[model samples]
Target: MTFPEKVDYVIVGAGIHGLSTAWHFAVKLKARGKCDGSKIVVIDKDSIAAGASGIACGVVRNNYYQPAMRELMTLCVDVWESDAKNLHYHNVGYMQISPKCMEEDVAEIFAQQ
Candidate 1:
C-alpha cells in the first residue's frame, strides 16, 4: 500500500492510548474547523490492541500515588462502567502490597481512592 506523503497526523500503534490520542486530536482539529479526520492515519504493526493491551490478566486498577494519574485512571474506570454489561466488567475490588518505604504513598493513594 502507498503511504501518504503528507498528513495532518500519523499516530503510532492502535492500542487504547494511541487510538484515544488520535480520536481526541482529530476531534479538536475538526472542532476548530481546521480539517477533516481523513488526514489522520493510524498505523499498527499487527492490529488494534494487538500488543500488550490485547493480552493482559484483565486486572484493571486505578490505584495511583499521583493525583493526576489517579484521575486519568478514574476516567478509564468510568468508561468501563459506562458499558458494564457488554464489557463483562467485574468490580472485584483492589489490593496492593508495597514495601515499607512506600507505605506512606500507598496510604495516600488509598485515602484519595
Candidate 2:
C-alpha cells in the first residue's frame, strides 16, 4: 500500500506498544469524528509481532511492588478485561508468594490500594 506523504501521527513499530497506541488513537479520532486512515501511519521494518514483544511469553499480572506501577498495571488489566472476549484474554488471575521478610511489605502495598 502507498503511504501518504503527510501524516498527523507516525508510529515507528508494530509491536504491542505501537499497536496499542495506534488502536487507542484511532478510537479517540473516531469518537471525535476525525478517524481518517491518512491521519495516522504505522511503519515497521518487519511484519507485525516480529519484535521483542512477540518473542517474549505473554504474561499479564498486577503484582507490582510500587504503588504507581500497581496503578498502571491495574489500568492495563482493566483494558484487557474490557475486551477479554475479542482479545482472547483469560482472566485466570495471578498470585505472588512473598518471602517472610517481604510479606509485611506486600501486605502494606495491598492495604494502600
Query: Which candidate has the highest TM-score of all?
Result: 1
Q: What's the true lDDT of residue 43 in model 1?
A: 92
Task: Determine the C-alpha RMSD for candidate 1 after optimal superposition of all C-alphas.
Answer: 2.5
Local distance difference test, per candidate?
0.87, 0.83
What residue runs in model 2 are displaced by over 4 Å at the alpha carbon? 98-101
Candidate 2: tens digits of C-alpha lDDT, residues 40-63: 888999889889988976777666
Error of 2 at 107 (Å): 2.4
User: In candidate 1, what are the lDDT values of residues 1-54, reduced to their tens digit?
Assistant: 588888868999999789988899889889999877878989999999999889
| TM-score of candidate 2 relative to the true fold | 0.73
